[model samples]
Target: MSNSNPHRFSLESFRRKLASVDALPQLCVLGVIAGVITGCLMTLFRMLLKLGAMFFMPDNDPEAFEQLTPMLRSALPLLAVTLIGGWLALHSGGSRHQIGIAHVIERLTYQQGRFPIRNWISQWWIGLVSVLGGLSAGREGPAIHLGAAASSGLGTALKLPHNSLRVLVACGTAAGISASFNTPLAGVIFAMEVVMMEYTTVGFIPVILASFMGSVISQSVFGFDPPFQKAGVEMDSFIHLPWIAASALLIGLLAGGFVRLARSASRLDILPFALRLGLVGVAVGLTAFWYPEVQGMGYDSMRLTLEGNVAVDVLMAIAIGKLILTAGAVACRVPVSIIGPILVAGGAAGALCGMVGNMLLPGVHTDPALYALIGMAAMMAAVLQAPMAALMALLELTHNPQLMLPSMLAVVVACLTARQLCGCDGFFISVTRYGMHPLQQPLMQALSRISVPAVMERNLTRTRRRLSYEQASALLDANPEWIIIERSSDDKPALAMNAAHLARWLLEHTADDVLIDAEGMFDLLEIPGERLELAPIHLQATLSEAYQCLNENPVDALYVVHGRRPDKPRISGIITRSAIERYYRYEDQSTTKNR
Candidate 1:
């Protein structure tokens, strides 16, 4: 128990300070391995994306790869046809193939840190194809998956212990983010702060190892700096706070709208996933007529926003256009994600707002570049509700102060608005969609339910007096599974008298008072199992879950704590063995009648 205290402390500290490193030194090598795998995977993903681009090129394009000949380009429909092959091959295995972060988390709680290795590759390939086929997706889904998978896979392949595997998975997730974005610190934060949810020494070693390794791998190929560079950000005037706040509010509202729209649009009750995604393709084709910039990754839109290339009229239109398209694409739920599209829309909107500010107040206006940065940040914060991720992204990618202030302000507002209106943080919404709750610290919740503090009984016989003949006789009369002779802090011998042994003793020994006084004298001798130990309840659990905790307990009786603290444990009472039998009987009867 004392040895485990350090692990808990590390996790707690890691959660508080995202920038800190406090994990174990022993796990450092694995973290580096996680980073290398993540970098390799990211590079592979980029190459696959290039391949996808080549496949979709028009016949007339001079830039078309030799691999995709003009004839194949002419028969463009073939590209869409074969893409399904990857998805099918990947998803057709077992139910385990459907595993996501949620499943990983579920395994963490009950299954001693086991994760499925064989199934990860299949889903990984499927995600890659989804993006390759113009599904309006981002790298996040696959990046984290690959990151976790690679680390978890490594642990599994090496035949490490269960706890070690969990640590490896954390390393993988961190490395994944590092490789994907070249944001090493953010990668560490993502793994420790988000995935592992451990802030203590446990996370420190893994997160640092993963982050550093991932950064090294990514830098080896893409260089140590950011891939896409722009001018440094500059601070804006405090007078523009109102404008920034207004923009933030508007982006938040739109973000909420986008979330709802996406969910609703994705609902193809009768159609399959492919069919639904194809429907999104149709929308893209139609929307392309008006705004072809929305066709691909919207790189053009981001560039144009920074350059202030679009007129006020067109900027607003592009914003709305991307918003609708993103919502629709997300609804279809193929390879769709809110990442690239939200940035595009938000940047465009911010640029438009900047233009307006420039027109209205000449000297006090915000910069186009600044607005562009803020827009990107705001939309990302709103849509994804990952303020730290967005802030770090802008900081690492742009390193501009002029943009930073508005970006931070807008991001905070947008994230808050999205949370208030949308009923979930961005990642949580996705987690919830897949039938899992996105808890900040699940150990906190798990500790609340069926914990040793909650289940263990404190009512051991405290009196050290040797049991009198009358008292021993009385204790035997009451049916106890195991009777303790006395309350003891440490190892002390107590009379271990079971009901059967007591009855046998009574039959042989002619104690005349035993038979008469022992009846209905349960409290005369202290029943050790009567006292209850209490722990905090995290609340919102169903009665059925409570029942489960009660049933699995070692003791025949337990308490359903109304609240967490023992002294103030609200309205609940002790649950006796007889009460449990009756409740089960009632439940069974109810089920039978309902059936």
Candidate 2:
């Protein structure tokens, strides 16, 4: 125990450093670590998908579901869902079935980013099966879940503080997006705009580093080529702006309807998992029978749409089919990836609009591909409610800066239409509404950034409920600000007494000859000092957690402790409600001054 103290103290010191708002160097190192971890995992995930495709897909093309016979295409989703449903039924306890970006957000918001190992494992095989089974899903959602779980697992193994763990989760999320899409800047923006839901200098540095590392690692394996071919198509005239805005409005309505459908479907969660997934299989199977282009991620369909090779009617059919099928899959809680399908559908819709425009104005020779690209960005922004991320993804995917102006216009219109006209929050937020809070309050956000140790009062000492006069005197000789009255039994709560109050009581008692001989024992609780009921809090807790603890427990202060044993935990420090308020007040003032 004595030897462990030094090591534990060093670790606690490290945690304290991370609690600071300016721990950029430490966080950047963590970011790099997270990126490398997530990147490697993402590579493995993609490789596995490719390997799976080799066995089932003709020509080893993941998107070659179109080449499969209609009967085979129809059967594939049913077979895949059967396996998935059976697997989920075996593990039908707890939240093991909950997987993907929505799970990531729930963990970050409610659990401080600690991911469960069971769900992480479940996501690997389930995600693989969903895409391989031609379930109108993307690999990106599963990749994000895997990345976040891996990074959070690393932090857990290292026993990092919760506040730092939150940052690491953000790092992993960005790295997942970066590795999956090979878009580092977009990855960082998505992590901030979608997952973390806030941006800060401290967060940006680590997320950026993680995203860069993820992209670098992914590029090394998959090469430096972007996913979509550069269409070399650009908008030639401003006369198309009104048409673009009109298309955005339509896309927004579709996105909002998609969200609404998914939310309404979530209500069916009370049904058996197998029943819901089986229905999803039937819907997807029937759709794939008619339009195999809607199966899988639909990247092949997207490519065709962008090249204007597909007929206008085909584009419209693919768009509507993908949207409804994907939404139905989501409603059935099939764990299908929505991002890839959303992009594919959006591009198709945009291409259909572009074809209509060309027909309407036969004199103009604008390419449908331009509208497809802009539509992809606009739809993504509307569905995710992340305009900056969508724009970044557009810029990176297309490697074109000129489209930024027009894409921005379409994105804003789509986002406004979806949010105002359709009344839909982002998809992830809406789906996980039961377990999520916006956490948008400024004071709460401010408090979450700081760990308890950063604001806790260390000028304190712990003693038993009863102490000899000399022991009490000796304890006060240290000039501690507070005295912790250790509970006599496991069931009783510990308490805190102000040192000044104890000192005054001692002085009065001594003057009255109550303890002149210094032989009597003093019951600290019985003394005339204000005693605050104390709840035990872990040393790694953030100030936000401390604030929550104070609110949830009928206590005025908390005794910070370490170790797993509640009966014999090591009390490290004391934090009063007043102390937390004072710290936040100082921080608020400092921020105001800086502003």
Candidate 3:
């Protein structure tokens, strides 16, 4: 309503501010919002899972699928998969099936942080069904999917810039991991390493804040108990460190094998959704029939492995059987996560090694729980290609500052083995390897850093396609950069003329007192102007989008607008290839030279 109020609250101003590198304070606010939203969602999801567990199990323990009768245990996966597959089969279009961590990565890399509501809605039910049905699944994948979607949607509603939205997505990702595991430090590292794929001191502060908030919310509800418990874990000796590192190497190989199998199974995307799910479900059911330890999140089994309560033979069965089944379930697009199951498999492998070591060398002090802790770190680091995050998780979960040396050694060995010997990228990337690359090149990366709103020319005046003498005279007085030609009813502008040229033309035909008909006498229509073949891009768009619009169409310039809706977009500014090129060429030269 007022001049200063409108100017201060304008979307263009907000977007331009977001484009700067010093957007930490605003991002911290968004981080709080993301943390609260994701924390609440995760709490509800966990409660629902508990409620579902009450229907069949003795207690409300969702992980206790083993307590069910053999017939019910075998039938649950098949029945649940049928219903889930049928539901997914019906709505399987666009981004419906794309609902998990891999999908989250794909959207961030390609869609510029815009996640669809359809996929977000589907994630809630699909994730709930997976764990409740007795399939070897993890809740973390669904939690991340739900959290990232909620954060992205919040940014979208506020008309935030894409760069800001991307940061919000990272915040949601951190919140998801932190709330799920109560490991705030690990959550921050995981978001930076796995999702955002880049890190800076300015960018990480908000992420750290969001992770801490998520942990606080979860701690209020779930209390201080983590998924795994350990008491006073210490290394046996420096001599046994070699055996532990060797075990990490084996876990890395196993991780590589698991990823490869999942990738191979993902090729069955051609098959009908029901058939693929039915086949995987049958496999899970048959496995659950014999070894129910393969069902649910397997955190219970992981706890037992740490306590040395699980027998060696049963541990071997769970370690191998859960690996193959979980890999297949994920590859076939079960919409479940492998984070929890991977930890279980690693713990089981470590427990078996500890048994063998104690039997062979009777004089040595062998603590299998310590080995299990190290194994959990190694498996997570190798499988996700996130060594720092896994190590942080190990420290936070154990609450022991002294295990850093062994954890780091195991994580490094595992990561090296997976990358060098096994020839594997992280599982998320390996499965979704369909010709997508990050903005890695220096110039492109630099271009992507700032938003279009920050760089676009805002010193322009809008007018009708044809201007009268008096109308043109008044516009020239302002000395605007360009005059935009448009009609009130049209979606985009018609053309833009250089204000200098119009000013020059007006000076030459200055016979105002002679009563001249400028339309016929001067023929002002022949004035030089650039034809407008402009495409509509959002204020949140980066220079990468500007380049993309130019490449995809026969257009030289773009109109920067506030929103994506077709009917009511508030036109803000304009951008051109020359302007974009000059901005980068002048500003980035020194940075590029140093690099």
In terms of TM-score, the best-performing candidate is 2
For candidate 3, lDDT tens digit of each residue in 504-536? 877777646323464623333466655555677
Winner on lDDT (1 vs 3)? 3
Cα lDDT computed for each candidate against the true fold: 0.56, 0.85, 0.80
Candidate 3 collision pairs: none
The digit string of per-residue lDDT tens for model 2 on 153-266 reads 888888777888888998999999999988899989989889888878888999999999999999999997765666567777898898899889999998998888877764
Where model 3 places Cα greater than 4 Å from the true spot, the runs are: 1-16, 93-96, 359-363, 430-436, 439-449, 464-470, 485-495, 505-518, 521-533, 563-570, 582-595
Give TM-scores for every candidate, taking all chains together and pairing residue i with residue i: 0.65, 0.94, 0.89
Worst 10 residues of 2 by lDDT: 431-440
**Model 1 lDDT tens row, 53-130:** 654555532123223443442233224324544355455531113444444455544443456665466546655554
Candidate 1 C-alpha error for residue 583, in Å: 31
Q: What is every candidate's alpha-carbon RMSD to the true fold?
A: 12.3, 3.2, 3.7
Error of 3 at 382 (Å): 1.1
Candidate 2 Cα outliers beyond 4 Å, as residue runs: 1-10, 94-96, 266-271, 431-437, 515-519, 564-567
What's model 2's TM-score? Answer: 0.94
